[model samples]
Target chain A: MTYHVHGVSASGNCYKVRLALEQLNLPHVWHEVDMMNGATRTDEFRKLNPNGKVPVLVIDEKTTLAESDAILCYLAEGTPLLPDDRLERAQALQWMFFEQYSHEPNVAVARFILQFLKQPGDPRLPDRIAGSYRALDVMEQHLATRTYFVGERYTVADIALYAYTHVAHEANVDLSRYPAIRAWIERVRSQPRHVEMPGVDQ
Target chain B: MTYHVHGVSASGNCYKVRLALEQLNLPHVWHEVDMMNGATRTDEFRKLNPNGKVPVLVIDEKTTLAESDAILCYLAEGTPLLPDDRLERAQALQWMFFEQYSHEPNVAVARFILQFLKQPGDPRLPDRIAGSYRALDVMEQHLATRTYFVGERYTVADIALYAYTHVAHEANVDLSRYPAIRAWIERVRSQPRHVEMPGVDQ
Candidate 1:
């Protein structure tokens, strides 16, 4: 049976799952939801994910998974996206956690507020921008010596972090200061079967 | 070489790494970093983790892993904390993600502000309370039927969520409204070798 992923096209959280699916060459159907219409808050949709979040993946007949990182790990297992060495795998998950805690909450939240909520001047904006740069600066320093977030090989850790930091400039978090991060982003984008943001005019 | 974890006693993120180590019966040295003294911000510590975050796990002579969830996964691999079933493992990661995105930011941030910053009426407090409850409500509903967060047994996902929600009330986000969540918290704590939050004086 074909897998089904329920998500919005423009959501980076959802895009993470889509990018993994594309990279894995996994055939799946995309069921688009109009998040702006509160479609995810509906009773039926909440049944699939009580959190009312997007990027729910239904596999086979009996299994469904939520959380983009979970989905990424699930699909990437036994594949190149997950490292074979245990220590390297741990490093992969390390960066994934960093993306969730430091990167996503700052960069993604800033973008959400600026682009979606149109709250560029929201009192929280300044702190969010500051936090975003702090996170980026950390990433910049780390990437200065490495090509990927984990081992020498590419892994889903890069995917998780790349999902947002690639477009961080949209939120006005400057990337010019981070030359290595820019190069790493380009390296990630050049990977085979890479998928750009869903709504962008490619 | 013995594993070494650099952490602060009061940090649940650090506690998570400790708990996983204990559960796995891994012998390790605990190095305390006084965040209150700005120990983590030192150049020496920053060299270990550019992000200057707590819960850095040093293994062997050259391998170091950061991020609590990532450390948990690393130690728990080949153990019961992680499931072998593909879909079940994904479910475990799903809860880990929920803990990060929905649970930790609210619970941890609120606790940090109220306990450390001493700013109860801080403009961010109200939203933190609201968001915490929203996440708790979803967790409560999920636990209404399942004995654990994922699979039929306890996993790292539970450990990840329990580390924070167990102390959430200190932030004024009541779990009383979510009876199932309250019960599950007890169930997790009841596990053998379970470690209470550091400084709890239990």
Candidate 2:
């Protein structure tokens, strides 16, 4: 019973799961969905995930998990992605939560509005950009002293944040302003088996 | 080195950690930070958590964890709060993620704006309220069939969601429309050693 992950190639939410699976060296199939074609809204996909979101993980035909962070934690368990030390594990989760609450909502949403929605100069753009910068400043301050989000080593928490932060500049979020975060992004990119988001390498 | 959680009673995020501690019957001291007084902005508190958000769980003298969900996972680890089965664990994390992305940002933020910020019926209120209802609708639909958020029994996932949804009405989110969620709220309340959020019992 091979694991299966359903998502498109370009989604950061989906990239979180993909990065974890690859890092863990887990063998799985990528059931691609052309989200642009409205494949995710189809009744079949809705049955798999009622929220009709991407990056649903199906394992052994018995357990189907939705939400990218959940899928990352699920696959990363018992692996290096999760720390064995109890406090370190908690710290990893802490950063993961920050990724969701502070980082993703601002950075991802800003990128969505700018790139996907093509609303670069919309009235909401300024505030969204400001919010993204605030989040980046927070991350920059944290990463200023540490190599990873938690502990001395990389974990799923890093993967969760890296999924979107790396592409933040694409949305006009000037990474040059945050030297530490920019350096940390390079560190994450240099990891073994690390894969950049589609078209990013090209 | 006694375990200490740094948080105030009034915060739902803090309450989630406190509830987990009480549910597990873990002995811990509470070091309250008055966010209204800007205690969280202090340098010392920021060192414990660069994010400066509570509750920060300090275990022994060397280990400290931040983020409510992370603290919940940390304290619940190796305890009954965490599911042993891999699939069940994944499901627990899935709901935890849902609580963060779908539930908390809407429900909790609405409460913060209305209850604390005293901005109820503000121009932003309608959209925030609508978002909360959309999340509630999703949860109600899921709870319509299942007793708990994940497995047949309650897990930390329930504790995470229950922390906010139980008090959602105060934020103008009428749970009465969702009988399943309302009933599930009662079920969670009926649990042994259940602790209510501050002012909730009144």
Candidate 3:
């Protein structure tokens, strides 16, 4: 079945689903949403995702899943992309939640403000940038001792985090001090069937 | 083996773990962290969670899991609290992710700022409250036709969302307009072995 993905190409959350689908060799069709133009705010888009967020994976006529990380788990299930062990699977989810809660809100929002909204002087930028570094610090500390986020293997957890961290510069967050995360990012990039997110400059 | 959970009682994130344990009849010990006194910031707490967040579930001496939803998934695995079907599991995770990203950050943070930090005048409160209502609108729309967050049965998704949502008034966000959510909250409260999170008034 061809998965129908409604997303914005330049969005890291959307990029996560695209990357996983490519790596897993899943059949999929991408439908780009004009988020900046309020495409997601339309009633038709809200039917796909009531939250009006990007990266909605329509599995079939009767089934649609939102939330990029959840979509990753769905697409990665029974594949090498998802861990086999129960604890390891939970650990994978741990990092994904961390990405959404601690990392993305800071890193992704900062990038959105700067790249999409073009509002460098926005008041929320300082807190977002500072929080981005804090999230990076936690990631750096974790990656300092491991090859991957879970089970020493590349899993959806890695994909979830690598999405925004790789493009943090667009958020005005520097990675110079996070040597471990930098190395990890390269490792993620070198993974088989890895796909690059379209640069924000696009 | 008994699980050791380190968390703060007043935190909705931590209460998620406690509630799941109680309802699932799992053997666990709770170690309440003095978050207001900087207990999570201590070096010892960092060993439990580098992120320095609460709701750290220690499965054993060598294994620890952070992120409240991840812990819920861990504790709920193989139990009825987690769904058995692949799509249903992903659906459960979808709501959980939604809770973390779209719901908790606003609802939970607003509650924290007000009840815990006693910051009624905090500048972030307005945006937080507005975001909380937007999140509630999504939940209310979803719950308008469903008995639970997933599969018409109680799952961790409900547990995850029920944490902060039931206490949203503490965030200074009203629920009078969200009849569906209010009804669902009552349904969640009626679940077997349901435990109350200590009131902020305590």
What TM-score should be assigned to candidate 3? Answer: 0.98
**How displaced is residue B18 in candidate 1, in Å?**
1.5
lDDT of 1 by residue, A23-129 (tens): 98999999998777799999999877889998899886666788888889999999989997888888888888888888888888888888777777888788888
DockQ of 3: 0.94
**Cα lDDT tens digits for candidate 3, A1-202:** 7889999999999999999999999898999899988999999999999999999999889789999999999999999899989999999999999999999999999999999999999999999999999999999999999999999999999999999999999999999999999999999999999989997667
Report the lDDT of model 3 for residue A167.
90
Instruction: Give the poorly placed runs of model 3, Cα more than 4 Å off.
Output: none
In order of appearance, the predictions have TM-scores of 0.95, 0.93, 0.98
What are the per-residue Cα lDDT tens digits for candidate 3 across B52-89?
Answer: 99989999898999999999999999999999999999
Model 3 lDDT on a 0 to 1 scale: 0.94
lDDT of 1 by residue, B11-124 (tens): 888998888888788999999887867998999998778899898998866667888888898899889899988888788888888888888889888988887777888988
Record all residue pairs in model 1 with backbone atoms less than 3 Å apart, i.e. clashing.
none
lDDT tens readout by residue for model 2, A1-202: 5789999777798999888888788898999887767998898987788777888988866567898887887888888888878778777878888888877888888887777777778787777778888778888897888999887688888999999999897667888888999889989999999987884223
Tens digits of per-residue lDDT for model 2, B24-102: 8989899978777799989999878777787888886666787888888888989888887877887888878778888
DockQ of each: 0.85, 0.75, 0.94
Question: Once superposed on the true structure, which residue ranges of model 2 sit more than 4 Å away at CA?
Answer: A200-202, B60-62, B200-202
The DockQ-based CAPRI class assigned to model 3 is high
Ranking the candidates on DockQ from highest down gives: 3, 1, 2
> What do the candidate models score in CA lDDT, each in turn?
0.86, 0.83, 0.94
